[model samples]
Target: MKAIEYRLPKDFDKSFIVFQETGKFFPCPWHYHPEYEFVLVTKSTGRRMVGDHIGYFEEEDLVFMGSMLPHVWVNDAVYSSGQATHPADAIVVHFLDNFLGQDFLSVPEMEEFRKVLRLSERGMALKGRTRRKINTLLKQMPPMNGLQRLSTLLTIFDIMANTQEYDLLASPKFVQNFQYESSDRFRKVTEYIMQNFDQDISLPEIASVASMGVTAFCNFFKEQYRVTFVEYLNTVRIGHACKLLAENDRHVVEVAYECGFNNLANFNRQFKKFKNMTPTIYRKTLAI
Candidate 1:
C-alpha cells in the first residue's frame, strides 16, 4: 500500500490565505499542517477521512479542521474511476493560530469568536442558513484581498459562532499522530481498505499490503491510527452501511450483504454499536 500524498502550495510564508481550486488531482495523503484549515466543497462528491471520522461528502459541504488534524478527501470512484464530468472544485482557507495576533482573542469583543476557534480542534461542519452565508462569502473570495479577506474570514467565524447547526467530527481520543512521518503507509492502508472493504479483510491480508509481518503490522497500524486494523475495517464497513441505508432502496438484509456483513444480525449489531440506532431507525431519521 502506498501512502497518501498532498500537493502543498508553493509559497509557505503567509500565515493566512484563501484560494480556489478547480480540476486538480491533488490526493493529499493523510497529513496535517501547523495551520488550521477551512474547506468548502463547492463542486464535488466523495469520501472524507478526518482523524477518526469517515463518511460521504457532497457539494456545498463545509469543513473546518484544527491544526495538526490528519485528514483527506478521496474523490469517489465515479470521479477517479474515469467517469467524472469535471474535477473537484473547492475554496480553501488556511491560517495560523496567531495570524490575527494574541490580542485579537483577548479583546472583549472577540470572546465568542475565540471560543469557536477552540471548539474547531475536533473539526466542524457549517449547516443550513450559515452554509448559505458561507457559500456567498466563498463565491466572492477570488476578488477579495488583504483587509477584505481578513474581514470576510472574521465574518465567517462570527456566522459559525452564532449558528446552531454544527457538529464535531473527531472524538476526544482521536489525537493527531505526529510520529507517522511516512504518509505512504497510511495512504496505502486506507486506500486498500476503502477499495476492498466490501470483502472479508484479514490481518494477514492487510499486513501483506504493508509488506510487514502480522504482529509488526498490528503494532504499527495501531500506533498510527489508534485503532486495530479489524476495528478500523468495521468502522469503514459501518460507514458504508450508513450511506447505503440513506441512499439506496434496498432491503436491510440486502444492504447488509452488500456492505460485507455475512449475516443480518451481525450487521445490525455492529450498526447499532457504532450508530446507537438500528439500521431501520437510521433510515427513518434520514427520511425525516
Candidate 2:
C-alpha cells in the first residue's frame, strides 16, 4: 500500500542513479519515469510488471526499461514474511535519454546504439552471458570515478545494443504521458489498490484515498493510466491469480476465491479477458 514511491538523493547531479538492493521485497507500485533504467537482479523470484507484460522472474534476471514505461518488482510473500532463502539483490541504474546530450546520438557512429535505446521503449529482458557481465559491472559502480563510470555505462549500452535475446515487454497502447502530477496520483491510487485489492474495493473507496471524488478519480485514472479503474482492478486480480497459479497447485476455485472474485464464473470471465486464456489452461500450459 506504500504506492510506487522512490527516494531521490538531494543534489544528485550525476546523469544516472545507481544502487544495490538486498534483504527487503521492495514492491514498487506501477509507475513510470522520464529516464531509462537498467536493472540486474542477483537473487530473488517474483512477479515482474514491465509495461503491459507480466511474468515470473527468478535469480540473475536483468532488464532495461525505457523512458515512461511502468514497472514493478513484486517480491514473493515469503520474502515479505522474512523467510527468504537468500536476500534479494539488485543493481539499478537510471539515466535520462539526453544524459550524454542530444548530439551523443546524432553522431553517425552511435546510430546503432540509438536504435537499441529506442527499442527499449517497449522494455527489454537481458539474459545469459550479458546478464553475468552486467552484474559484474554494476557491482563495481559505486567505487568508480567519473571516467570509469562513463566507460562502464558505455559498455553496458554496447552490450544491450548488440544483444539478440532481448524482447519487448509492453504493448503500444501501454504508453502514457510522463507527467509528475499524474504519476503522483497514480502512485497513491495504485498503492491503495494493491493493499486492498484482495477485498471489496469500491470506486468511492479508492477515490477517497486519492482525495478525489469518484467521478474525478475515474477520469483522472483513465487519463493518466489509459485504463478504467475496473480494468486496473482486473489486471491486479489476474496478476495475483498468475502468481497463485504458478506457485501453488491449489484448486482453481480456491485460487479464484482468494483472488477476490466472488464466483468462479466471473473470475473465469475476467481472467480469460485479461490473459486470453482460462486459468486451467494457463496452469496447464505452465506445467508443460
Candidate 3:
C-alpha cells in the first residue's frame, strides 16, 4: 500500500505526547509521520507493517519507529468488525528528534542515543528482556508529568541502546529509497510485492510491472533494495509464514505453501535463513 504522510497534533504544553489509545480497532492507515514513536500494544491481536516488513503482533508488542518511517497496525477482523467483546488498547508516545532541543542530542554525552536514533530509522521490534522492561515503564508513563515523564523516556532509550534483544524491521534500501509520492518506481515496486508476495511472482512479471526488462529490473531492484529479487521475495514470504505459524494451528508444510513456497525443503531452508529457527520450533515458542 502507498503510505501517506500523517501530521500528528502539535502539543505546546509538552515536548512529547504520551497517552493510551483504547478503541474497537486502530484506525490509522499506512502512513508516515515526522515524530519518533514508541508504541506498546497492551491489548490486541493483529498484523503490523513497518516499511517493507509484515508480521503479526499481539499483546505486549513493543516497537520503536524513527521519524518519517512508514507504518500501520491492522486489527484482526474480530476486533475491527466489533465481533469481539474486548477492545484494542495501546500506549503510544510521540516526540520529534529535537523535542529536548536540537542541541541536546548533539552533545558528546548523548552519542549512544544518537546511534540508537539512527538505528531506529529502520523501525525496531524490542524483544526478550528489553521488551518486558520497556513494557513496564510505558505502563507508568501516561500519568507522569514534567521531568518524571522525560526521565522515564530517557531510561527506556538507555535500555534500548544497551540491549541486543531487538530486530531491525525494514531493509536498508527501503529506508533509503522510500518516498511519500505513490507514483515513484520504488513505491510501485513495493506495492506490487506487498500485494502479490503470496502468489508466484516471476522476475519478468514484476519487471513488466516496473516497465523494465528482466535483467534491467533485477539490477534495479538490487540497487534499490540492496538484495537480489529472489532473496527479497523469500524474505517477505518467510516473514508472512511466521505470522501464519504463530497465529494458526496449521502444519509447517501448509504454512509454507500458503506463503508461496512450492516445496517444503526450500521453505524450511529459507525460513531458517531469515528466522534462525524451524517453523515447528517457532510455532512451539509461541505456544510457550
Candidate 4:
C-alpha cells in the first residue's frame, strides 16, 4: 500500500531528533517521512512493515531506513490490549540526509558512509553484533547534546558501513517505483487486507473495498505495488504465520487455517516458496 506522508515534530534545539517512546502501544500509522530513521525496539513484540517487506519484530530489533521508506511497527495483541506486563518502548532517531550540511556526504571522509546510506534506501535490518552495538549507542543518544550526539551518530553510521551483519529489507522492485502520492482508495484497500487477512477475502470483496471493479482493481494494485493483489495478500498471511509459529508450538495445520489457508498442503507449499523451508523445518530451526 502507498503510505501516508508523516511529519516528525521539528526540534530547533538540535539538527536531528532522538528520543525514547513508551506507551501502551506504538501509535504511528503506516506512514513515511522525509528523513532517515533509526529504530530500535527496546521492549515489544510485533510485526514491522518496511516498503514491500513484512516480518516479525521483537525486543532489540534494529532497522535503519532512508528517506521516504514507508514503514510501521504494529504491536502484538498483548501489548496493544494494555494487558501485557510491560508497555511497548523503542528508541527512535530521525535526521535529514543533509542534517550536518548540504555538502557533508560529498566529502571524501564520508565515502563509506555514503555507500551505507545508499543501501539504507532499501531499508536494512541490522543484525548480530552490529545490531547489538547500534542498539547500545541509540540507548545512549537521548542524553547527549550538541557535537557529542552528532559524533555518536556518525560513529553508528561508520560501524554500519563496515559491518556485513545486516539484511536489506525492501525489494528493489518496490523501492524503484514507490512515490508519495495520496490515494484514499489505495490506503483503504491495504488497510482492509491487513485487518482481515486471517479471513477468506474474495477478489470482488477486496475490489469493492477499493471501490473498483475486479479487473480495474487488479491492474491498479499491480501498478501501484508492483505485485498482484493475491501475491501481496499471501505475503502478509505468510508473514503472520511466521510470527505465530515463532511465538508458540501451534500445529502447522492449525496455523495454516488461522492464516486463512484452508488447505494444509497449499500452506506448506506457500511457506516453502516464501521462507525457503517447510513449515516443520522452519519451526524446528527456531528450537536450535
List pairs with backbone clashes in candidate 3. none
What's the TM-score of every candidate structure?
A: 0.59, 0.59, 0.65, 0.64
**Residue-by-residue lDDT tens digits, candidate 2, 145-192:** 777888999988787766676655554334443223335766777667
Write model 4 residue lDDT over 1-288, tens digit each, in one string: 347999888678789989889999999998999999999999989888787566789999999999988998999999988999999999999999788889998888887777677667768889999998888889998888778889999899789878878876664434543332338887687678878988999999999998899999999887664468887788778877877887899899999999999899999988777666788886775564
Cα distance off (Å), candidate 2, residue 36 = 0.3
Q: What's the CA error at residue 144 for candidate 3, in Å?
A: 1.1
Reference-based lDDT, residue 272, model 2: 76
Q: Is candidate 1 or candidate 3 better by lDDT?
A: 3
Order the candidates by lDDT, highest first. Answer: 4, 3, 2, 1
Worst 10 residues of 3 by lDDT: 174-183
State, as a TM-score between 0 and 1, how close model 2 is to the true structure. 0.59
lDDT of each: 0.74, 0.74, 0.82, 0.82
Residue 5 of model 4 has an lDDT of 96
**Candidate 1, residue 93: how far the Cα is off, in Å:** 0.4
List residue ranges in candidate 4 displaced over 4 A: 177-288
lDDT of 3 by residue, 66-89 (tens): 999999998999998898788999
What C-alpha lDDT does candidate 3 achieve relative to the native structure? 0.82
Question: What's the lDDT for candidate 4?
Answer: 0.82
- Candidate RMSDs in Å, in order, are 12.8, 11.9, 9.8, 11.6
Q: List the candidate 2 regions with Cα displacement exceeding 4 Å.
A: 1-7, 10-13, 176-288
Query: Lowest lDDT 10-mer window, candidate 1?
Result: 172-181
